[model samples]
Target chain A: MRAPSKELTIDEVLGRIESGMTVGIGGWGSRRKPMALVRAILRSDLTDLHIVSYAGPDVGLLLAGGKASKVTYAFATLDSIPLEPLFSQARVERAAEFREWDEGMFQTGLRAAAQRVSFLPMRAGLGSAVLENDPDLHTVRSPYDDQEELVAVPALNLDVALVHMNRADELGNGQYLGPDPYFDDLFCMAAREAYVSTEQIIDTAGLTVDASLQSLLLNRTMVTGVVETPNGAHFTDCTPTYGRDEKFQKAYATAAKTPEDWAAFHERFLSGDEAAYQAAVTAFREEAQA
Target chain B: MSDVTRSEYCAVAIADCFADDGEIMGSPMGLLPTLGARLAKNTTNPALMLTDGEARILRGTPPLGQSGDVTEGWMPFRLVLESVVPYGKRHVMMGATQIDRHGNQNISAIGPWEQPTRQLLGVRGAPGNTVNNRTSYWVPKHSARVVVEQVDIVSGIGRARAEAAGPAATKFHDVHRLVTNLGVFDFGGPGHTMRFVSVHPGVTVDEVREASGCEIHADGDVPETRTPTDGELVLIRELLDPTKLREREVPSS
Candidate 1:
């Protein structure tokens, strides 16, 4: 018998998201973020989300929509672009519960969760105020050595993980053609359920043509569902497939600077479905060309 | 006399931050430092590894934003963090919003932790990077505000604090240098205090002292930072950064 398909619509993936649950969005800052899934959540009435990400517009959108109750991230940047203004505003206003960490600590925490462990010991935050600020973090003495103090970082177990990739097979096997796969596989393993959205869906055999591409593939067993989302990581980068839309990103960044401009931008771009958003972008490009 | 710009002098100072550790990764954050690392790789330090701000480690400098960049091999984030960082085979030059006399740098926040006056990028990877690798700084503008008496928060642990954290943290706790537009500073003084190494061509020791928020150690007469060679200048201007992005950071005089 053939295996049951693990394919779902973007709305179905968004339906699984509930308020007050920890959600992990895969991608390094402003790169291959699960933007379609993010937009679905933005459109939905979901609130009080505890988000975990290397962060991009995913953090900013949730914070701006007043959907996030907490955010645990290493950084919130648009990479070569300006900083994510909404998230910056959230930090200034004390709008969310913060569990800030070094990038290594955050990555290790995910690895621990993937391994079904309670915590992972790391030396990253030992000498810094990171340990002082996070009261819950304790120093674990090495079993073998008496002279060592390693910070015990907790496992970041997630309810759902959202990731966008370069390609996927129908059975949820995903591949990234980009330079860095980052911690996407770890995020999938860390979460109870993982929904993968891809720019294209190829046959399973097509994934193996290049040995380099095989290294970028995510295992099907860990993926809960797959959604084919062409141009999914728009505005943000999706490298090797397509570059970041600089004009759109610039406009978005400019809009995020103030409330009035952000409101206008939200209506023009963000206040619609993915197709509508695409149409608006097409219209803008045409206007620019003309 | 040589035809060296202020930016080129700054680049050489940044490049000089790295030790002659053979075949080590040089991950410089901003534009000038990036160009500096590539400059060092081509001219002085052939073993210095460089990337085109991505995964593939470049064999030669490539024009920024252009295709056809030559790659030595791939060194993605996973490989770099797992192999390079853990083994102390990497040197990184990062930017700082605030750095103290003790070298504790802060890029996370501007004021109090609870109610920050300005919230910058949270301690991204500084903590891990500092404790695991040789880390340096590139301050475009060096002033009392940028180099504070004491950092509001320590994003990267300095010498004294790293030493106190015991053996594991201190094993790789090498805060090498701080390359600024005005001068080059290193932690070579007593108790690893911030010591002014050399001033830029136009900048003086008095000017550096006036700009510094705290008492920075300068034992004797400081000389000018080394001027870039003609070949090095050619690589910087032509190959590494054809757009002349370095000029924007510290304008050529």
Candidate 2:
């Protein structure tokens, strides 16, 4: 596989971003999120972008930051992370479009896109207010002319996808050996360009033999770039290694209570280059160590 | 002693599962009882059951906490009486043997019933019920296979399609919601365009796309979902039916 381009700044990574591009992300319930990439996007002033993600903290930040225009999702991590602030505020106040789906139903929609079918048949409409409340989800005559009931889900053509993992090779073949293997590889394969962050770079061979689902779902070809951001998905467990620190999360939750607070927090946590991030974490680690 | 108080724990954590403006499926969390729980208000059935055992409540008082007695080997159903059954609205979130981005799911057999790549509970209320329940799903683990090209068997609906010659079409058509370990999502706003809405606390955009079996309408600067409130954590723990842990009944001193 070709080596990643030497320009390692988040700015460089994101300079290639364009409007109307579909983006995907990885993380679950404040675990293993790619903060560096997010911070970079926030500073760039990109707007009206469509986003895709599963459950986690990054979803709120994107909307609050005024970067995302439309969102597609499966689940947002954490138990009671109310979505009222993002959807209600972003749409009514900021004019962003926010919609929701049953967690699995969103996955089915992505599956239909992957298959390149006009519409996928499902038993979804039964007993669902989704059939009534949301005009987006509806029944259409089968384009295949096969008397099958089908749900027409528009194909998702993404511009980029970002993921965080336990380890990734030079070619972006990432591996996550965490207790909870939240969907990272699935999002990567579904996107056009994929970026990965990892705690360590290990031998590529171990990736194949590893029994974890994270490794099996991804291959070298799937990855676009890889960066060694140690303890990167940190504060969010990487099983058999370390985990998300409770103290930090509590601090973050409390600190990012408003937009201004979020911007300031992002500046401290995700603003600088890798070297700066390491210096800050190192300083914090040393303080705790002392 | 279990960290936060039970009610606070459930309330906060359940709220944490969604985007700030996203819709919910539970009873109390959906809307106030006086206001009729948010998700429950969507139910058309007059004889609908409330998450709290009440037929219909407006004030939305939480249900009483009462742990059940554990008998011999019945797998011990813990009395955390919280039920998504109230959010049993036209839309519901359920488990799956397999799931895709279109929101399709299967609790049916992966291989034969006995031996399989993954041994999941069979049928899981999807056979006849999927046609009636507005269903969504949760995949704690996201991968190519779990988020496969297509399910080995269609146990539940993902897209908007009518059953060919199977069960007759119901009032609702398909699953409208889908949440995973990564983010929250629904069908498209204008054209049912499937796109990524929000990411979880620590999740990155790339991880979601790779795990998803299909392409997503993802944006560059997606938002991060917020954390659940202390109250929500309690409700999710005590009320949303039992999951992950056993709700404790501490005897009054």
Candidate 3:
């Protein structure tokens, strides 16, 4: 028998997420994030979320919107802009519980979850304040003769994982034509359910036509659903399709400076569906040219 | 020549860190460090491997902000975390928002860990980088604000912290070098306090002492930082940074 289609709408995917659930967001700091889904969550009534990510604007948006109760991350940056303004503001105010891990330890935690293990041993967090700050992290001695004690990075299990890609089929095979695949696949494997939003939803065979086999980063088994959303990763980069919308990002960053500024920005751009957001962006670009 | 810029001097000092690193990955963070790593590869350390700061390992050192014609291998973020760091075959020169006499570096926050008055980049990879392999630092502007008595938070392991973590942490922990606008420093003093190796030309030991919050261990008269050779200057000016972008980072004094 042929496989059943696992296509979903933005709202349908958001329906699967619950309040206080651990949601893993895929992408590495203003890269190919699933911004469309993130916006949907922002629009939803979902609150008290526990977010895990190599964070970008998604963390900022959730924090600003007062959706997240806690955030676990290695870093939160907008690449060109060193520190994300919204995240920075959140940190200053003590808005939420922040669990900062070493980059390698964050990756190891995801790997542990992906492997369905309780924890993984690594030396990334040792001799650093990462342990002292987190406090719950423990060290384990090797069973072998060397008997080295290493930090046991606990598994970062997720209730749901949301990722954005270049292309995916209806059966949920995702492909990325970009330079780095990042840890998107691990996020999916570590989650109970995984959703992918793509620029294009093509036939399964077309996934490998132009792109190399290695670009097929996610198999159907890893993805619970797929959504076709063009320009989904706007502001953040979607790569070959589009670079980061620097002007829009600058505007967003500037707006984050004051509450009134953020309110105006929300009304102008964010207080809408994906289509309206795209239209507002189009008008924003037109205004810039004029 | 005698007409060497502070950036050029800094680049040479940064290059000196990788002089003995035979075949390890030379991962540099900012403008000066990038130029230094490229300069090292071109002149002294030909075997040094360089990444495009993204995924691909470069075939040869390319100019700043441009990937060259060819690549050696694929080294995505996953492989870097899983293989490269664990393998202990990399030397990284990262930036420091705050550093102490003990060499504990912080890029996390300013006031406090829980509720910071200002939040910098959250520990990105400093903890892993310090413990897993050789780690250096590049501080463009050095002051008492930056060279603090103690970092607000320890993102990178220093000597005291490494020793406390025991042999497992100390085995590969080498806080190699620190190059700043004012001077070059290393954790080589008695009890591994930050030691002044060389002060930049026109900069005095007193200036470094006044600028730093913590005590600097200078045994005797500190030497002047070396000026780049004509060959290195040519490589820096022509091949590496023709746009003189390095000047923006560490403007000529």
Please report the TM-score between candidate 1 and the true structure: 0.96
| Per-residue alpha-carbon lDDT of candidate 1 for residues A1-290, written as tens digits (9 for 90 to 100) | 97778878888888888988899999988889989889888899899899999988889988988989999988789887747888888888888888788888888899999999999888788798788777877878888845677889899999999999998888989899888888899999999999999998888888878736545558898899999988889878998788888888888888988999999999998889989988988887788789
lDDT tens digits, residue span B1-253, model 3: 5678888888898998898999989899988899999999998999999999988899798888777748899999998998998899999999999999999999988887989899999998999999889999999999999998899989998989988997789989999998999999999998999999999888999999999999999978899998888999999889999898899999876
Docking class of 1: medium
Candidate 2, overall lDDT?
0.51
Instruction: Give, for candidate 2 chain A, the lowest lDDT window spanning 10 residues.
Output: A79-88
Best by DockQ: 3
Best by TM-score: 3
TM-score of chain B of each: 0.94, 0.55, 0.98
Report the lDDT tens digits of candidate 3 across residue range A1-290: 99999999999999999999999999999999999999999999999999999999999999999999999998999998888999999999999999999999999999999999999999988988899899779999999998999999999999999999999999999999988999999999999999999999999889887889999999999999999999999989888888899999999999999999999999988899999999999999999999
* lDDT at position B56, candidate 3: 89
Better of 1 and 2 by lDDT: 1
lDDT of 3 at A70: 98
lDDT (CA) per prediction? 0.85, 0.51, 0.93
lDDT of 2 by residue, B204-244 (tens): 77887777776666656878654554444444444532342
Interface RMSD of each candidate, angstroms, one decimal: 1.4, 15.9, 0.7
